[model samples]
Target: MRTTRSSTSRSACLPSLLLRGGLTAVGAAAVVGMAAAPALAAGSTTVGPAGDYFSASLSNSATLTVGSVTVTCSVSQSAPSQPLGTNSANQVPTANSNPAGPVTSTINAPTFTNCRTNMPLVNAQVTTSGTWGISAQHGSPSTVSFQIPQGGLEVQTSGLASCHAVTAPDGPASVAGDWTNGNPASTLVFAGDTVPVEVTGGFGCPTAATQGSFSATYQVRNVSTPSSPINITA
Candidate 1:
């Protein structure tokens, strides 16, 4: 799936050698701004910079043994709070900032037919061909996979270098994958259903370096029961 994606890029180029405190400085600046922003109950995940000769691997029940992939994701529930501007004719009360006030949930039901066509990697990976030459930068491609099962629905997510808060990001996008295990003759059994995932933006990692380490959670939803929740305490 060679679909167009949106990602912010910079022209600053660093030497091939390890950056001495360069990344640390950049992260410190971004985190300062993030802390001043409001907070929410939801969380996110992000991966840091890896070496050029690195890997982007996505796995599951029946793994894809051929092509390579790496996916990134960030999940947050903090809504931006824009203060009342001075241009307003009347004075307004100071907006109350509440990180634990309430959360609004948006729900949807997608198909789960257990067919290959029904489920494919999210952040679709398109094969781009070019000469393996130096002087030009190479892009790290990845795939996001979510899983669904007959027992319940599971959302599995993954991300690459930019999945981190202090790097390039494509916001968030969601896709569903239909998963099935076993034969199709008579005793066909479904394992899980999942798809590509695009979550919210921001630093999902919480570390002592950044006040605390990042914590995140994964959930499962079903018709017969409430979603099974995983508390992502980073």
Candidate 2:
């Protein structure tokens, strides 16, 4: 975000006028200076890999309200450390480029709140595998955009005997905000957003239906921070 400068200006003679009346021109100059000052500093912000090796983790949490039931979901993911290049000789970072290799992420044990009593599902677990990418932008404070490719949100659920695991179709999911370089903390936080996820399992209770299909917009989040650069032999 940038702040615009005020176009208001005072006449140069006004300072001389004030000084002639036994009053100092300091107050008048101060007023003019304040009005002319820009509301915000100007600079380019960018974010990307600081070194050859990069690693980060993302954490997500959200609440789902189905009919009258509300369930809370929490997920934690760890991305494999990726090499920007073989060595510093070719480790030059580019603006708006993908990582050197496909970065795989593992979803940790996910937990839900008030799921058993409110919904037909007994327990839910996300798939262990997922993919991520970083899009770097050029500027003074460089920014990096994070994204999880489509079809990356794989989920498995366990419930009544008739219920079975189902996978959500691939769709593009991304962090709500960009991560800027030179932040105090290494970790970057993302806001929550809704993602459409498909599931195949038994619906209802007692006479549970088998092979049922359902689509829901579930809330998800990504919170990860890159690790410091590590030197590698070319």
Candidate 3:
């Protein structure tokens, strides 16, 4: 009779122990599942007026300063022959969404005019060579930042014997700026951007400097449809 009673007691406790163990295992599994959940997915980008040419004109005068020399350009893109700059394909209907810029376009060099140096009796001439490129970098709803590929813009400066400089012998300089979408035209602003340049002249040159800076604002418009503004959504 004593043995039977002990056996019955053990059997009654078995289900309770099993239930507790199973509940603990399930709780741990739930926690692991939550921790492994994935993040939100990104959407694709779209551009308006697809497959159209766009030009950029200076909304403000451009300034380039290297060491002791400061050059200001008053006229850019006044005529068709002296176009400020051009970019290929104002449209990318199906572009992958990435802040690191998976979209790219070919860009031409810009011409500067009415350029003069801060130093008296010294003139400034700026020349650019090679086909540059622009790529999307990062952006928000209203504006997007772009990265101009390096080594595409070769800025060679020649003028008075006292003031001459170049970007690099084998390599060229590049820049970064922001673009804002609008109706009539888009805007590009370069606020005190730093570019690499070296001085290789005799007197009054920024011989001791290894870098140069420039600032300008440009308004972009579609050539085919002057009223259509370039729009980039990411």
Each prediction's whole-model lDDT (CA): 0.15, 0.25, 0.41
Ranking by TM-score: 3, 2, 1
Candidate 3 residue lDDT tens string, 1-234: 001111221222211111111111110000000010011123344455665556667766776644334556665431122232332323232442445333455444455666665554455555543443444433453333222223322233344343344443344333445558877877766555454444445443334454545666667676667777766676
* lDDT (tens digit, per residue) of candidate 1 on 51-166: 00111111211111001121212211111122323221111112212233311111111111111111122221111011111000011211112111111111121231112111
Q: Model 2, 26-138: lDDT tens per residue? A: 00000000110111122332223422323332233333322232223432323223332333211213331322311112121122222221344344333322333333333
Question: For residue 191, what is the lDDT in candidate 3?
Answer: 55
- What is the RMSD, in Å, between candidate 2 and the native fold over all Cα? 23.2
lDDT, residue 91, model 1: 13
Top TM-score hit: 3
Compared with the true structure, model 2 gives a TM-score of 0.41
Clashes of 3: 0
Query: What is the TM-score of each predicted model, taking all chains together?
Result: 0.15, 0.41, 0.65
Show where candidate 3 strays beyond 4 Å: 1-44, 77-102, 141-160, 168-172
lDDT head-to-head 2 vs 3, winner: 3
53 in model 3: Cα distance from truth in Å?
Answer: 0.6
What ranges in model 2 sit over 4 Å off? 1-45, 58-75, 82-121, 128-130, 136-145, 160-171, 178-184, 205-234
* RMSD of candidates 1 onward, in order: 22.4, 23.2, 27.6
